[model samples]
Target: MIKEAIYHRPKDNFAYAYDKETLHIRLRSKKGDLTKVSLIYGDPYEWNDEGWKNSKKTMTLEGTDELFDIWFVEVKPKYKRMRYGFEIKSNENFLIYGEDGFIEKDPKNAHFYFCFPFLNENDVFNAPAWVKDTIWYQIFPERFANGNPLLNPKNTIPWGSTEPQFDTFFGGDLEGIINNIGHLTELGVNGIYLTPIFKAKSNHKYDTIDYMEIDPQFGDKKTFKKLIEVCHENNIRVMLDAVFNHSGFYFEPFQHVLEYQEKSKYRDWFHLRDIKVKALPEANYDTFAFTHLMPKLNTENEELKKYLLEVGKYWVEEFDIDGWRLDVANEVDHQFWRDFRKTVKSVKPDAYILGEVWHDSMPWLQGDQFDAVMNYPFTQAVVEYIAKDEINSEVFKHKLIKLLSNYPKNVNEYNFNLLGSHDTPRILTLCQDNKDKLKLLFLLQFSFIGSPCIYYGDEIGLTGEGDPSCRKCMVWDKDAQDTDLFTFLKKLIDLRKRYSAFGANGQFEVIESAKETNHIMYSKKTVEEQIIITINNSNSALKVHLPFDISKNESMNLWDNKPQKISEIEIEPLSFSIIKL
Candidate 1:
């Protein structure tokens, strides 16, 4: 046995309450070191005539990465408490592992085993159930439409007339969205994640001037209220962006601090390196990415925290908004988010709290903070494999499997998955306008775990580079838009809704093919149905042999809703097929 290679922690992802009644435990051992492992667990308080009453359960090998094999098991202690230890067996050695150290035999004392004191229901991570079922549509308010042209800003230009810049506006507003709710409904999206709409200086609205009022460029308070009403009536949930991380340069308190310097009453509201605030050559205080216009807020300030907490509670309580997508969430203090969750969930218990965290987010997802973070790691891997072709099928699978193993299974279900957003290049441009590659990427995204999102113009095949280019006006003209791509997306969305296996929480399996390296096969299965999706990213047609027999079961093609009788299948070049069994 490789005693030093074995590792187990009593908290976090290693051992966590998967739900209210089930405790999930994970053990890591050196890859290829152990063939069989078993978990011996029982209520710590249970005592029998011999010693402590216990039960032994075999742990299944959940997954293996480059260096470790992860073993997992879910147990429900009768008394809602447990003391567990591992019994690891290799080809030539058998050893018992406990909290203290490895021993040749099982410990005589139960108290020495790893312990889960109690299964507290409140500690189990709980997100809004509706979130995982949602297909999110992200909209940049200024670029989506120009329904009420009269409300256009003074600098507003003709819609889609020019390539967008940092300061230009095309007058997309709440009224425009209200007029276009039918478009969203037809697209089959159930959730709308609008970029920051609170009063702000720029078109994107990430730099907030005021949190209580809607941006005049977007619309007034009453207009937004009507937009929410129409969205709910159409069964679409609305989530607004919260920019609590920083305030704009002209924000009241921030402006006051700039004028008075050391003597300002609100001096402590921001992190100032010097008493004199300067923005000409460089900023002397902390700001968002050194842009002096966006002054970072002191979230630790008690007064500021209370005010922001009210901001969180107000939107949900007043407008009945479904959730808040926090901006620059990682830079803020953890305690603020914990209180933010409490305040918002108090009024709307099922309200979703999604953070804009681009990296490892295990710290904020422990039930006390945000429900989920943006899954950028997933986005990076997909973009590299599908668009750049930087990694082959085998490498892609390994990277994806390793990423999925980082979090608990339940958290994976609610992760906010996206292909391209306001921050990245459009999907079409990323794939160099190859429609076949784009289709393959979409098939992979919709069939993968986590809630998926469509950036505003992506479904219509809009192509652009990064930053301002990615934030283009929505193409409403039928002749100019890619109608065929739009129709394909709608059909795929409909099928996703119809198939239980296509939804979040379905079991995922990667199937390896003996015939080709450019081919990839995966299946999503539920108790009611199973779906097998096969893809050919190469440019040549290939014959894909099934690893198992499927001739006995009735099979249908999910793309065209056509039935197919088969033993093995032929896949066209640069395309994918979804088979429902």
Candidate 2:
């Protein structure tokens, strides 16, 4: 046994309450070091004259990263408290491992083992239940559709006339979204995430001029209200973007600072180093990424805090919005987000609060701030293995295990997973316009554990580079669009909803395949069925052999529902199939 390789903590990711009654525990050991591990647990006070009363359950090998093999088990204690330890078995000998270190035999003293003082309901990480089961559709609203071109700004070009530029507008508005609810309904996604729709100076709407009003190009309050009513009537939930990290240069408070310099009452709202300064290059105030046009706000100021908190509450209370996707959330202080979560949930208790964080997000996901983050790590890993061919199947599996282990199980269920967004190149472009590779990427994404999102027009084979190019106007002409890609997306969405193992809250296990190094296989298990999803990312067809005997097990291919055998399987190059066993 590699004694130094064994690791576990009393709290955090290693051990935590999954819910009011269930506690999840995990252990890390050197890869393939221990042959088996059994959990010995019981109530802290459940003891007799002989010794502490306890029960033992074997732990299963969950998965492996680069250096460690994770072992996990869930226990429901008769009482709400627990004292537990591990019994590790190796080829040579068996040893007892506990808080007190290695021992020759099981200790009669319960104090020698790890302890969870209590399982309080208040400490449970409670995210919105609906979020786990939802498939989201993200819209870059200005380029989604054009219901009324009369509302277009001056110099508006024809719809999809040319590649999108930073200043070009395609005249998309709330009325346009209202006109296309059928498209969303038919696509089978239940949630819509529209990027910044508030009053703003730029076509993208991230530079907010007014936090309370809808941009004139999009529509007025009444038109937005009608849009929301219609969306809800069709059983679709709407989530708006909140850009509280900074405001547009022409915003009233910032304009007051510009006019009055040091004497303005709103001077404290911004971080200014000098009183006399102008323009982006010369401005002495802190801004968003050195762009003086979008000045960063001092959320610590009491008056500024009140204004922003009201902005958070107003949409939920007035518009009946279902959720808020915060912009530049990591740059803001944690206290402000805590208050934002409280304010939004006060209006609608089940409202989802997602943050725009691209890195490790443990700080903001403790049940008091953001429910989940953008999950960019998931995106990068997929691109590296499937699109760029920069990493092999083993490396991809290792990266995914590390990513999934970074959060609690509940947070993983609600994570906002996406392949491409307005900020990145389209999926087809990332795959070098390879249709088979794109299909494989979608299969892996929808089958993984998280809430998945699709960028608008990505379903219809939209392809472009990053930023402005990725924000092209939606293709409304059915004849001009790629019907094959559209049908593929619709069928993928239907399959995700039809399978119980694909449920957000179900069991997932990655099975390592030694026969095919370029292939990845994982299983999704529910109470009624077990499914094996295999993908071949290489150029040559790969042969896959099962690790277990399924000679008598009933099996079928999930993609086309064709019968499959349990013997060695063959996967075509850059293609995937799901087998129900």
Candidate 2 structure quality by residue, lDDT tens digits, 472-528: 999999998888887888887887888868656557788864325578888888888
lDDT (Cα, tens digit) per residue for candidate 1, span 202-270: 999888889999988888889989999999999999999998888998888888888888888887888
TM-score, every prediction = 0.97, 0.95
| Model 2 segments more than 4 A misplaced | 50-53, 91-105, 275-279, 514-517, 548-551
What is residue 142's positional error in candidate 2, in angstroms?
0.7
Look at candidate 2 and tell me the lDDT of residue 375: 93
By TM-score, who's the top model here? 1
| lDDT of every predicted structure (CA atoms) | 0.87, 0.88
Q: Give the TM-score of candidate 2.
A: 0.95
- Count clashing pairs, candidate 1: 0
Clashing pairs in 1: none
